[model samples]
Target chain A: MSSGKIVELRQVLAERFPREIPPPASLLTTGIECLDRSLEGGMRRGTITQLVAPYPSCGSASLLHDLIDSMHTSASQFVALIDGKNSFEPLGNTDLLLWIRCENANQAVRATDLIIRDGNIILSILDLKQNEVQELRKVPLTAWYRLQRVAADSGTTLLLITSHYISGSCFAAVQINNPLRINDLAELSYTVSQTRLLDFIYRKNYAELGYAQA
Target chain B: MPKPSLFAVIYTPYYRLQCAQQKRLRTESNQQADLPFADRQTELSDQYSQSYSSNSNSITHQTIPPVTVYIREDIASALLEDSQIIEINPTAEAAGVKIGITPSLAVARAPELQLYAPEVELERQQQQALLQLCYRYSPFIESTGPGVCTLDLRGRRNKNQEIWARDLLSRWRSLGFAANVGIGPNAELAAQAAKFANPYLEVVENSQLLRSLPLESLQPSAYLLEILHNWGIRTLGALIQLPREDIGQRLGLEGLSLWDRAAGRSAKVLHHLQPPEIFKETIDLEQRLETLEPLLFILRRSLEHLVLRVESVYRLVAEIKLQLHLDSGDKLERSLPIPAPTQDITILFRVLSQYLETVQTAAPVVGFTLEVFASDPAKHQFDLFYSRLKDPNRFFQTLARLAALVGNNRAGIPERLASYKPDNIRLRLPAFDWKSNSSISAESDQPRIGPALRRYRPPIPATVELADGKPICIHSNLIKGHIDKQRGPWRTSGNWWDPDGWEIQEWDIQVTDRGIYRLTFSAGNWAISGVYD
Candidate 1:
């Protein structure tokens, strides 16, 4: 048969005898409605989910602290946060949180690689949002792809936080654009966390996102 | 019905000499791995054949004079003036080198004689290895001597004793020791059989082999043996032929014991020994090591052997202690604790290698000793709602790597200090023991206060345009914007009585279209402290 006809015949056979699909992996919830809803309930295991904060006072740090608090209190799981610019402030109960305060983007990426590959942590947050864009640009694209492969192999949830879209290796991306005002300082953190809105920006497979396996 | 107790004795003749040879052979084998394939096989074949023949009792004819070798305690070389030979290889025996003969006489008799000194540490290590291997056969084992041990086979019911005996022999041989195993009704007979066995032997009650054995096999004192020689008692059968009461009356208590041992009727009281849980390996480098690769290579090999030993004892390595002896008469020691006890070599090696990477040696290392503390594997029951670390050892190793990448005090479980100083936080290593006591409260009654602040490490310097004691516009390299609204000058200070005293006037302000930033005025200088996100 011709190649086109052979493809048609295989499609017909596939429709008649469909392959069994495995169940999707369990999701790790951050307990934030807006972010979780943007992630379709929560971040899926063995995938990279990027959170982009385009401007200062965009509530990325607030979101990160809320996520860490939610992991510690609600799920009782360990979270490793690789702080990109060493900018994270202490807040809430951090008994189950492993915070690695790195000086630059390179150190943060390396720390992220080490934590993700350890396979002991359930969720790893790479917070590079506060880093200078010039330094963040120096982080090779291959590092993200390598991290994606490691996360996939280790069956971990890797949340990459950045100032803008930097790599196509992530499985999904969401933009946190809530601008904070001086008045918001008087409000409760949980209320602010609940009021935050996330815009779902990107979702695709590794190959579709230009991360081809070698 | 209670079965008769059978004793098995494992003995190695010239144990100190053999330990030295084994150490040499091991060093040679390690060097051989780098040799060409053709040269490696030929060298190994020649050396191993010589080693096997030296341990063998069978004699072979030689047309030419063989290389005769002997062991002495104080010899620096074969030409040492007055050192006496304590142990001699079979070839040395054929060449007329007698025990207790001086090295000068030994060389005079055998022109190509070689002398070696005993390695006390290596001998001790091999003896411990032998005991550890024997413990696998029976829990009730005794350390009879430096190179001998006896296992009590009371409850074991395998009729085919040769299988396990051969198995034990092969296992001992794998560690470079040539050993013999003998099983008998009593410990005395078993020890006698072990000295005579080609590789293995078994003797029963009143067995002809036991009767024909010479009196020297009983290890009587020289004085007693001389008396027995005068009496013309040449063999155990002859000694046992005399009436026991008559010998006891004539020769006293020592005579009675000797006769009992001869007749295969000695007491079987074994001082049972519980093998020590010491897992250590040390190596003295042939040349001083000045680089990390070779040191790491040795460490990796040592860790493998230690892991094997720990696994054999049904335990895990809880901690590793490394001591590096330097050429400058100094020792650098480090102890790395395995958060979760494990038999995994990779994790253990990582712990060691990571430590070595940061070690700053003052001199080239001459040797290193690695010792592991063994522990029972930890067991824990996690709560249904709680998730525990999947691999604690690997996670700790990763934590170490993260610490290397970041600062040491910058990575771990973060806890806020009790003091009111802003950003007063410290990182502590996570607890290794995973006891699920519900120490962490699952739910908290405290409310989340507000959005978290991202603090600038050093507080970015800024020029503030102040009007009426309130900051208006902020002009910094990072952020330059006019202030639309301002909060207050919150004054906070502490530690005024000490050298590290601090005071600050902090204000929260909103710069138009830029962000909400915190400004601190301290010591007549204004800075952007952090951003409230």
Candidate 2:
């Protein structure tokens, strides 16, 4: 976030031409491209999911690209990429959403400011090495319940990409999505738009008719 | 004539688009003759990607072909900013003006005859030679960038580390590069330690230790230093006392980590290398060199010594340095980034002698030294059975050719050094891996902070194009670029409580070849976003 004013993609576009503001769709993905296809075409939003990897090679960034692309193409959504380690170097075509690169858990907390200021989807590129998650893990129940408790919290789907690194007790609540290889990101994007068996079956039965909401 | 470099060379481009085809951004690189694939050690390494799988190959096949007909304006050297960059691209870097002087002083150096001006070719020959040099030190070499490198010594410990250090020091000194060695548990601290030495070396455990060194040594944001000053924490040691929670809560993560770095709490590591390895050496000259004859003669022997030292070892040296002090004590160091990495003293003398005669003299030469550094080692981490493959010196030959093309930086290995500042944090890719490999970590298991824009020169550039006889951002002196349509001027205000606060108004406009350029005014300065194709 080079500028002091961090604006969302839609805001930047709509400020020039105001239009109806639609709710964002949260597309979660298993960091693995193959695994993401097995899911409902993409990772479902509004739910917490955990990713596990012993090594850095796991498709963490690739999955992030998927999740971000999902939030972007499915609907014009803004995203927050909290890079706790100061690692995520913005690629060329990533401005479709509002991406925030923060350094630690502290800046992550300020995430509230970004959401309130520019409404959009949010994800964490956290450096799990920070001890905060370990502390957060002790009482994930209280923390998450409180997070859920915040009555007026906006509808941004917060996707955290911490593997063995993410330590909050809340992690025990969700199913894990593990991706391998840094290159896997491209692999996951290709499958996001493709029709999957789950999509066909769900659409025939329980799947939402339109897009999933944040 | 200088004996030709006995090294292999290879060059390649990053992602390139083809005008002829509609899809697929393919890699544009060239390969060289086979070099040895041996290493002193191997990690939890995998060669799963050396040879492309049919899947990727087929993927590339679906891509477009390069078309000279539609080169990008930047690639075609049509843009004004790019025109300035064109001159910086030396055919070959004069052994990379080994010593970095003030920008003004660098400009002052005479445009002497080029010993080797290898044009910047599509292929990378310098990388091959650099890898050879790094291989001599360790299997795990991480490139800091062209002309600079780091070797992680923690994992690859040897019997005589100091002796090894001194030998390499003399080697680099002989080549003309100011070699500085920083030893520490993490890569950042070691890197910071290496900065003090202009041909200097030191070791520090943490930022607290390093902060005591000098403020300029640690490249953090200016705001960070200001915050430290207000807090009465002047030195790195003084700053370390402020609680972690206090820093994290106040300074933001990069700021907090910078404070931590000052306290010497770093854990970042080197990344796995691409192909070649990097090598280095600084002068361990006898307190002084006597006459010009003995001085040049001894420098040649040291150069030859370095050449033979790595003969059986697994690496090559494509660069050479001549850091000498005149009787007047005004030092002049000269280097050339040629493709040929050699040990032949006579050849070294002939190549260097031609350029030496051309340098303006202030006094008699007192100290003369030379050093050789690299691109990447020819040996990459493979699942091969051999533990260490020795270099056949072919990589040095390739470096000679490549160094002759792109300036010196292009001739060595590249490594990205992490920085709090966007520009400072840009990758400082060097040529030594073994020195850098020790710092690499297994998992990047970091917490998701958020999406950060890695804009080296922020307020990403946008050419406000012609529209209705106007360009975007055309009017305001602060807001540069062409003026297009002036959208709404939306403003956001927050963080009023903090000294470092913001009140910004933004406008979206369609810039030149660039897409929607985001023009912003925060803190009374205009910045444009949306750099384009």
Candidate 3:
């Protein structure tokens, strides 16, 4: 069949059976008030969500640790962290976190792909925040799309933590605009607790966009 | 009378020869697998070069025909000595080699004939495989002979007898043994039917089918056979025409039994025995396995067969035991326990492969045996609040692959070691059952301490200038900047009595505008320890 005919047939079917269309998927709430509120209840499942940390001392790493901690304590779900730079420090309880420490951006991305495809982990965080920008730039865009498709198929939540926005197929992107200060070191937990995350871009009809690209 | 007890016999023709050929094929495949990629490539290239060079000399390709082979009855004798050939393959028969012929005469008939001694161990293993497959059909089974198994289908529903028999025969074929099934009213009749069966046969009317047979079919005594021959009685129908009481009184008990057998009336009871539950397969390699590829290939094949056996018995493998015979006369034995009792091949392979990846043997392996312990499936009830792994086997397999990609110590659940030393942490293997936890409540609820430090492994050495016991300038591979703010000179020490004692002073400083970093002075050297993130 030609592409035009297929599209027409799909349109006719959709119009004929409007009520049969599925409702939007429920979000996966991490139980973090700030994050859940910013993401409008929680992160979307089966899609990539980019969390950009533009500055070095931003609370992205802290947020990751707390996010994992909260997920474990509240929901009792497992979280997988693909550490790009092998820099995460285990200060708190990490009984539910499966940390795969990699040396570079390429290794981290591959690890993320494996974890997502396994489907055992509900939320997978690919932390490329500390990796070199040049190395992150070398990651092909097609790799991101492949990851998105796998996540969609597996019904997994893939959160990409980066210094700059790299995934064009992400369902949404959130930025941590606040940078840590020396005084904030006195009460680090309090500072992280006060973390303010801003939503930058959210594709409400992300599935249509993904289909278009595909 | 109730229906006569049906009997099914699974027969493998030329069983010893089949076992030898199967083993030879396996060994050849293992040798191919053992060859490294470069060596295999070189071999291929050599073959190609030889073929290309030979093409110019001949318009037609010349090939060496395979030599006809037969198994000798008395394997203890030397090949040159005169020996009787017991089992002959089709190739040998096609070349005019006949059974019961002397080796010398057979060689003269088929000059390319190759005689092989029987392998008792290989035949035993093949027989066990046949019995294991037969056990799937009926419980009252007998090890009737070398290549035959008789199953008593007394209470079994005979509606789908042909279907299950075909399935059983196919399973036997998968183990590299071509077999046939015959169902009859008696064991002897079943065995006879199996020999002539086209893969499967069933005796419907025993008297009608048995009457046409010659007296030799019952293997009567030579004296009795000669008398019957003189009496002009060649077939069972003719012999049974005589009165049974008169024949018994005249010919004796042996004659009476022979007449009964010829009439398809078998009074012999079956000596039933349980099929051995032990699941193990061993191979003696022709070449010592110095690399892992061939060993893994052998193991994967063996494990697959063992799993099939376990499945046939309606059980799960609880543990896998691997024993390797090394050239140095030492055996390496290891048992790997499965987290979940499962028959998944991928998961079991991962468990074995992971162990092999880390093992360092003192000598090349000459042979190996793989065994699996079977168990009933486990039952577990989980808490309502927590979620468990959807597929534990697949999850563990993925974990093994991840461990291969990353270092073993790098991928797992991170546990903080109990010590004052900084960055003291170890990875714990993840559990199959995951529980929802709130163990972090104490730490999370505790007054906020500070941001988590992203520590650099093997803290980078740095050149520092200090004034008034405070760091003023810092230069390292990570950061080179003037200290905009400095906070700590916290002193700590541990293990003072031991030679591995250490003392350190740490300072949390802001690198001008770069970031807040942790600087440490230990053993009279300044280093950038970590960055606060």
Candidate 4:
């Protein structure tokens, strides 16, 4: 209907075409290969995972750094890092650090106090190494429940990177350990060799396997 | 021993050119304007073999010419709702078309340049705001123009400035802007370097690339630029090979700047946003009510908002414009002087209301707009002295109410001749003169005003029916009589020509029991001035 220009345009277009598919989207990869495999294609935006780091320098900061670098829009973002010991250093760029706030520290309250706070995403890192976490006999059970509700209500992923603690009040206690296996090899030398084991497990799910670590 | 050469410490300031100035720059002609250039060069050559200075042997000049984003008319629709695209079309030439043409062509086709002009300005503003974030990285960032900004990622920034630059590019892109940054020894190169869609980073060390770039990238006007392109002399290298004389013969004076630009040199520097001379916002209400409550309330909120906005930028208010629009659509703009910024809403409220009352409210007020102009060069230092009585904000609130009742004009400081000689030179007027730069110098360092001086307006003749010098009044105006033990003709005179410029010098006369009394002679009449310690 649009005339000869259409016919000329059609004749001009009967050639090659660029691919319609877009370049592959880049995802922030967790260096732990086994964990990455469990995550399928790695942590997508909606996926939430618990970060239970038992020690410092155990790649907790490394993971966050990679995530922030990959996202690259944290400057305008509202990031909440509840550093119990005030150790969550927002690295990368000073320009990026301008928008993050570290609240819920040196507090005067129950965990319920933190539950009411506002933020786009909340990262509450409790220092299991601190005396406060170790001696929490006075903390009310309601406080712990409120903390969980805070993360759930806000839809914020709460990464609890902490040291290992021996809590006596155990009800079917279970531990998920890093896959590294350290075995005694005195015959060889003082230096030891180990294989890193990476897998997920739930004792309750494995009734037959019982308490075997995956 | 050989002396080592030190890199030049360049200090460039961005001068905020007024809108009129920018317009003037756009219209300035180049070829005809080159008469001065030819004459200057001729004179220089006569004095010294000009080639010595003109030698292009070592091209030290860097071009950081600013690139304003230009969207072709067709590209407009594509960017209409895109916030990432800062719309700054100065000319609506391409009002019909909407998006997708090359960046260079978008610039070429734009006639009115509304899209490019305004976009660049807006981009510059956003960039400056970005600079607020960038300030954490380095204070060396200088704004050359809208979108045409320069930063000296010098010192420690040398290590991460590239990464920072890359990150910034991504940030801008995410924000929906096609931002390109070029960094060189100066701003000119950085700007020209920003034209590419990809990360365009250039250093003076990368000067070799400048030669290969087109003369269109230099300072050529769009028309002449198109001609050069059609001629196939696309690159700077192609243009430079032409005898310098021929290029000059054709392009004229712009040829000189072009030569400098081609050498990657920019004479244009960053322009700083000096605190605005006047920042104002006026609101027109739906209807007019005579009561001072709402007017005062509005004034309070507006003052708070203005203070908050300017405080982050600069401090103090030099002048205030209170424009009241009557229901009949008549606007009365009352400009007033503010000695300094008064955070106290009450003070402003009172002042504005009083000014409002001065308005013969022939019709109900439909709306009012308040604008404050301020500039504090940091010269006026304050000395430790007596504190101001009412908080500025509180004072405004009070004044706002008074203005609403009496009129804003009447609510201001009444003229009292403080000087013995009331000449234009020595007339002691209100600290805040509505027509002057009322900002106080150096915050404060003055002998405190006496308690008597707190509230003093000149005088009305009082009948001295000599009693114990206490006080007395008859109602025509407040009248008080006291024994005149100390006497002196405190003569105040001003305005040799104008009838309004009168100087009434007052004497601090003390009676044996009345303590200190202020007596002034105005219109050849003596009135009780004020009390003093």
Per-residue lDDT for B474 in model 4?
22
Q: Give the CA lDDT, 0 to 100, for residue B387 in model 4.
A: 23
Q: Candidate 1, what DockQ?
A: 0.48
- State fnat for each of the candidate structures: 0.80, 0.03, 0.70, 0.00
Candidate 2 lDDT, tens digit per residue, B1-533? 64311111111111111111101001111111101211200100121122112223221211111111111212211001221211221211342322223323333442431111122221122333344555556656676644445665544435344545554553433222224555555666666655554334445455345757554456667887776777676666666767888888888897677776776676555664745332333333333444344444444444554554344253345567667766776788777654334434455555665455446666755444456663333345542432221222222332333333322433232233432222222222223221223221221223232222222134533334435533344443224555434554777766578885567766655433223334666665556642110
Ranking by lDDT: 1, 3, 4, 2
Instruction: Evaluate model 1: give its lDDT.
Output: 0.79
Model 4: per-residue Cα lDDT at residue B64: 13
Worst 10 residues of 3 chain B by lDDT: B62-71
Better of 1 and 3 by TM-score: 1
* Tens-digit lDDT string for candidate 4 (B93-143): 244333444444444555433322222342333344344433434555555
Better of 2 and 3 by lDDT: 3
**Native-referenced Cα lDDT, model 4:** 0.40
- Among these predictions, the greatest TM-score belongs to 1
lDDT of 3 by residue, B1-533 (tens): 79667899998877776766655556554344323344433543454345435545322232211111122322222122237888776667777778888888788887777666666776787678677778878899999888799999998976668877876775565455667898888898887778778889887545566778788877788999998899899998888888889889989998788777777787678899887888887878778988998788777767876776776566788899999999999999999888778766677888899889878899999988889998887777877978788888778778878888886787898877767888878888887675435566455566548887887877999999899989999888888989999998999889999998889999999987788889999999999888888
**Candidate 4: DockQ?**
0.01
Q: Local distance difference test, per candidate?
A: 0.79, 0.40, 0.77, 0.40
For all candidates, state DockQ relative to the true structure.
Answer: 0.48, 0.02, 0.43, 0.01
lDDT of 3 at B521: 94
For candidate 4, lDDT tens digit of each residue in A4-106? 7754454444323322221224223434444455445443221123444343223333344334333323222212233343233333231221111122232
The residue-by-residue lDDT of candidate 3 on A1-214, one tens digit each, is 9977865665565555443222346488877777777777788888788888888787787888778878887888889999998889875667788889899998888888999999988999999988988998899988999999999889899889999887877887888887788887887585566865565655534233423211
**What TM-score do all the candidates reach, one by one?**
0.83, 0.26, 0.75, 0.29
Candidate ranking under TM-score, highest first, comes to 1, 3, 4, 2
- Give me the displacement of residue B378 in model 1, in angstroms: 1.3
